[model samples]
Target: MAKVFFTSDHHFGHKLIIDFESRPFADVAQMNESMIASWNTVVAPEDKVFHLGDFSFLNKEDTSSIVARLNGYKTLILGNHDRGRSRNWWLETGFHEVSEYPIIYKDFFFLSHEPMYMNKHMPYVNVHGHIHGQKYEGKNHFNICVEHWDYRPLSFEQIRDSVVVSEEG
Candidate 1:
């Protein structure tokens, strides 16, 4: 079966992110190539990938080129830096779907570009991105930033299992 994966903060073509996030890539080209390879390694063409945000810093043509070469049916949740493009523009660029705001999945995962206010009192798990190297503390908050997941998309089962393990330990 095709898997459902989540990831974000790719910041593709953003050279400054290399230094900002302390990414080990020697340069932007290497960073972009390595990330694309990593993504394709695990995500199949039929897989569904939900990218929380900060997908890219490149222009439409460049971004679309990158997205076309990637594997999976991609969806993007707009992030702070993603405001430059309209939802329709994003759809035309290659993303199968684009959401201007947060969305709920599986009736429990509050998917957003930025971490939402999730506490023990709430029954939802906030799966988010955009913080890069920083992360929130709590079993209810799951950061899918590429920095946290070895620059690869993580499957839904992996995220759920992690939450379960955290709850137990």
Candidate 2:
């Protein structure tokens, strides 16, 4: 069966990201290469990946190249930085699909580019990015930022089995 994975905030070609987020990489090139390798390591060409957004800061041609090199059938949920570009632009860049709002997956997880303020008491969980390396204090809210996930995409089971969720708020 094809697995579903989640990830966000790639910011490819954004050199300042390394210093801004204090990323372990020495430079942008290293960060990009490592992220690509990490992504391909777990995701097969046949799997599905939900890239929650802020895909890249590179030009269209460059962005397209990066997308082509990665594995999985990608679906994009647009982020703040992803705005202003037409929906067609994202599809043309290689995403199998694009979304402007949060999408509910498997009737449980709320997938969004930005973290939604969900309570632990709620039945649904919010899996999001945008807050790189930041952890919120509850089970219902999860952050899948590249900086937080070891620069790799996370499988659904990996998330579902994670201890990120707490038994109490």
Best model number under TM-score: 1
Tens digits of per-residue lDDT for model 1, 1-169 = 9999999999999999999999989999999999999999999999999999998889899999999999999999999889787898889889999999999999878999999887678888999998999979888999999998899999999998999898999
lDDT of 2 by residue, 62-122 (tens): 8999999999999999999888797889999998899999999997789998888786577
What lDDT does the true structure give each of the candidates?
Answer: 0.93, 0.89
Runs in model 2 deviating more than 4 A are 163-165
The TM-score measured for candidate 2 stands at 0.94
Model 1 bad stretches (over 4 Å): none
RMSD of each: 0.8, 1.8
TM-score of each: 0.97, 0.94
How much is the lDDT of residue 20 in candidate 1?
98
Model 2 residue 137 CA deviation (Å) reads 1.5
